[model samples]
Target: LGFALTCQYLAARCAFGYGTDLRAAVFRHIQTLSQTELDKLGSSTLINRITNDVTASQSGVNMFIRLASRAPFLVVGAIVMALLIDWQLSLIFLIIAPIVGFLLYFVMHRTIPMYGANQKRLDRIARRTGENLDGVRVIRAFARQKQEDERFAEDCAELERSMLAAGRISAVLNPLTFLILNLGIVAVLWFGGGHVDTGRLSQGDLTAFANYMTQILLAMVQLANLIQILTKAQASSLRIAEVLETKSSMQDGTETPDTASEEAICFEHVTFGYPGAGDPALEDISFTLQKGQTLGLIGGTGSGKSTLAALITRSYDPTEGNVRVFGKDVRSYKGTALHRCIGTVPQKAVLFTGTIAENLRWADEHADEQTIREALETAQAAEFVDAMQYGLETHLVQGGRNLSGGQKQRLTIARALAGKPAMLILDDSMSALDYATDAALRKALAERQGMTTVVISQRATSLMHADLILVLEDGRCVGQGTHSELLETCEVYREIYEASAK
Candidate 1:
């Protein structure tokens, strides 16, 4: 009880720290996540780690300290106390102890790998379910609900099968253990009868020996239980180790930037690939966007548009080239320094469960209400936010569920602008809004002083206003010029413009 209480107290404190640190780490990880990685694991498994996996690990640790630690002490002490009663009967314990050890050894070895597979299968199920739920609206819209349901059910079945396999192994061990223990007790009685008949052993001594035999068997049971706990823990440890040991594919070079760029963003023959991918996502990409200039990017899906944004912010360093910002290579700026300078609104607008003000503060914690209001106005969000009951303090549910798609998109843009970053990136963020809203937002951004902007979009109206536009296809820069120049000179650019106009 004392140990249990102590563990409960420590668990409460550890839980708070675990929650805070893991939340921050996961958030940072999401920011740096590439599309390839996201596609590989999906959101649900990530969510489970942030919730279920961590919970399991903490529970396991708590059990290890509370139950596993004390049980062994009790078991060992009981065994030693038993040995002092009768040495001849203690010889019976020595025989069965090794047998129990061998049994536990077999169980542990078999169950450890099974438990590991079970947990991974659980992660897969979580990922599938999460993907289905998040995209339920779209699934229904496309009449693919049945298809998604089937996929989720398949994952669930696989998880169940894996878990049952482990359970079956664990379930068999106990009965086998009881049988072995009973046999040992019968042998003790058979041997002790002759001693008692010849008056070689006292009646009390035989009774004590019988009781001690029970203790020895009980100790074996404890050892078996400890092995089971360790099996589960071993599996969990490996999963956590996978995440902790993963080296970020992007790392800074020892070569310092001897010189800096005057431009806010510069890509020098930049090349990058998804980790372990065969081909580069962005190859031989080069660009220079000075402070206060708007550089627009246009391309088909998979044209490395967002990859370029990631490179600019140093989410991933170019595999074969340099990405320079603010007269220094971005690698030179670590942690807050690099992040503070660049603000990004991704293609999918993301929001947390907080007030509008709180979400904006994510970009700039020191930003005042006035700064937030200005950003909202710039993104065309202030009018709607003002009409709400709480305005800046208006509560936002997770993923902005309370708001329209366009509202969420505008809120993301507002978040980017709130930081007043030297460089702002909108990665197809305006797709949800009407052309009117998109145009107004762009115009407002244009009016902002000394803010360099990058826009990745498919819309002609969006990129038409840019100082320069780069057209991309198949990971190569096929066109680079003003809107008119691209339309006249680049066939791909003209085809895109004509298609959008249609």
Candidate 2:
């Protein structure tokens, strides 16, 4: 019993240790993967690869350790004991063992492919579950609850059918093995009884021989169970390997960027297309921003404005030319140096489930209350934040679901400001705010002239005050100049300005 406890402890230690390490590694690798890779591999599949696959592998390790010694010992020991009891009765072991081996081989081989198919279907079930949970509000708002329920039911039904099919195949292994072994036991009694009558085998020896045969049968059954576990583990391992085997399409540079120079950002003849895209997203895009100036990107939907910003951030390297920061290629900037210099507010305001202070700390871990308050004030978020019962300690629900859209946007901006980055990127983040609030936020940013700013928006008012503005249309910059200059020379800019004035 003590030995068994020790064995269990060691097995648990190894399984959990490997699982933790593998999970961390997978999470880190997923971070390295580009958005393109994320698009190709959906969120649910990746979640399964990280969580479920690791669990299966751990279970496999536990099963192996538990059965590795015990199963073989029982089988071999039983054969030896049977031989000692009666040499003639031991022949039944030799005759029956080969047939059991053949059965195990046939079932195990057929079960592997089934397990693989079931795992794939399980991924679909996970995907549907995730979608239902995340989009619950949207479904309710659209009055599609019944339809969504039916869709989810369909997903579940298909998964259940596949699992049942695989399970039914596995079910056959036990009854068939037990039947063969019981028949062998019956044969042993008849043959051993004859020996006993002839005075060649005693009744006691016959009984011992039958018991040994039962041990061998039980051991083989356990081994068959191990085969089932191994099949599932093999499927899970292959899925995990697919993720580990993928190389990140984006690579980081070794060089650290110098941020003291006058030129904060530059793009020269840059053009890029996403993988498998028919046309380039950005065609020969070129721009520059001085260290203390504001650059605005104004474009219609699908005008490639966001693509240009991604180039500066080095989210993807340009297929044609160079994107640089501080007189060096953007690709040459090391991660810390690049991210430290840039604070980006994405189009979507995503907030984790944590206290307001906790979420703010993501931008700068060491930021104090005074710094955080100042950022909130600048983003015009101080009023509502202080109004909360717990103030900065107020807990935010996932994605800031408790707050209005405008409030969430302000908090997102404050989070970015807390970092005090050299370059601040506000990517159409103020759309939810009122005009008065928007104006106030812009005024606050204008006061901070030392930090380079890039504002991308469709509203001309958002970019009218910018030091330099670029008008994008169909992936090309048709105009580039100050607002007044573009109004006079560029027809596209004049038309946009004219329309906005209405």
Candidate 3:
């Protein structure tokens, strides 16, 4: 009993280690993937693969370690012992074994595909759950709680049906194996009784033969359970392997960037399209911004303003032309080296559950308190942050849900500023703020010497004061020049400016 306990404990420990290593490896591989790959896989499905699938594989490893050797050994040893006692009666073993083997094989073959389909259904359920949680506020505002509930229920029902179908098939293995083994035992007794009556077999030998048959039945039951676990594990492992085998389309470069270059950014006739997209998101986009200058990007909805920013950050490579940063081709610089010089506040304000100071440190881990204060001031967020009871120590809920929209945007901007990047990209991040606050933030940004800024906005007034402005229409550069020059030379710019004036 002590030996058995020790073995079980060791098996659990091994399984835990295997799970930990597998999760870590998958997470590291995911980090290497480009944004295109991430979009293709979907975050919900990736979460399921790392968590639920890994757990299933771990359970299989634990069960295999405990019962893999012992179950088969017991069955084979019992069969050999019965043959030693009475070789003539043991002929029944051949017939029973073939039937039991066929049954297990048929069940396993039928259930493996079902198990794979069930896992995919599980991924769909996970996706639905994530969407509901993330969009809870929108659902409430639209008064669609009943609609969401019905959708979630539908997914759950499908998962239940699939699971039950697979379970029913797996359930048949044990009972059928036992029934065949029991029938084999009765045959042994009948045949052995005649042998005993003829003085060829003893009563004690017959009793031993019956006991061996019982042992084979019990062992087969254990073997059946192990097969069920292994089948599921096989399915889960294939999913895990799919992720591990996917190579990142983007390769990291070896060269570091030249931080002191005068040219901040340059796009040379660049054209880019998302994977599987029909048309290019950005077409023939060419522009250049010198160091410490403010460049504004004004575009209509779906005009590819954010897509241009992603190219500068090397999130996706251009399909046709080159994007250069700090006087070097973007593809030539190491990813970390390039990102270290650029700070970006995306359109969506994202925050984690932590103190305000912790979130700021995400940009620069060693940023001092004074630097944090300066960032908040530049973002026009210092007043509200200081008014909070804990000030910088105030803990934020997930995604900063406790704060209002404008407040979250300000904090995200401050977080980007804490790094003191050479180039800053604000992708419509100021849309939540009022006009007065937006003006104040722009004034603050202008005063920061030696920092290049790219402001993307739909509001024409936001870019009127910029040194250079580019008006985009349908992924094409329709106008390029200072605000006043564009108003004079470009009809598209004149129309946009006239409309915003009202």
User: Best candidate, lDDT-wise?
Assistant: 3
User: Ten-residue segment with the worst summed lDDT in candidate 1?
Assistant: 252-261
lDDT of 3 at 235: 87
- TM-score between candidate 2 and the true structure: 0.92
Candidate 2 Cα errors over 4 Å, as ranges: 84-95, 190-200
Estimated TM-score for each candidate = 0.90, 0.92, 0.96
Clashes within 3 Å, all models in order: 2, 0, 0
Question: Quick one: best TM-score, which candidate?
Answer: 3
Taken over the whole model, the C-alpha lDDT of each candidate is: 0.79, 0.87, 0.91
Give a tens-digit lDDT track for model 3, residues 1-502: 9878987999999999999999999999989888988888888878989998899999999999888757878888998999899887888988988898898888889888888889898898888888889898999999999999998899889989989999999998888888888888889888889999999988999999999999988888887888899889888888888888888788899898776899989999999999888999999999899999999998789999999999999999999999999899999988888888899999999999999999999989999999999999999999999999999999999999899999999999999999999999999999999989999999999999999999998788888789889988889999999998998998988887888779
Extract clashing residue pairs from model 2. none
Inter-residue clash pairs, candidate 1: 260-327, 261-327
Give lDDT for model 1: 0.79
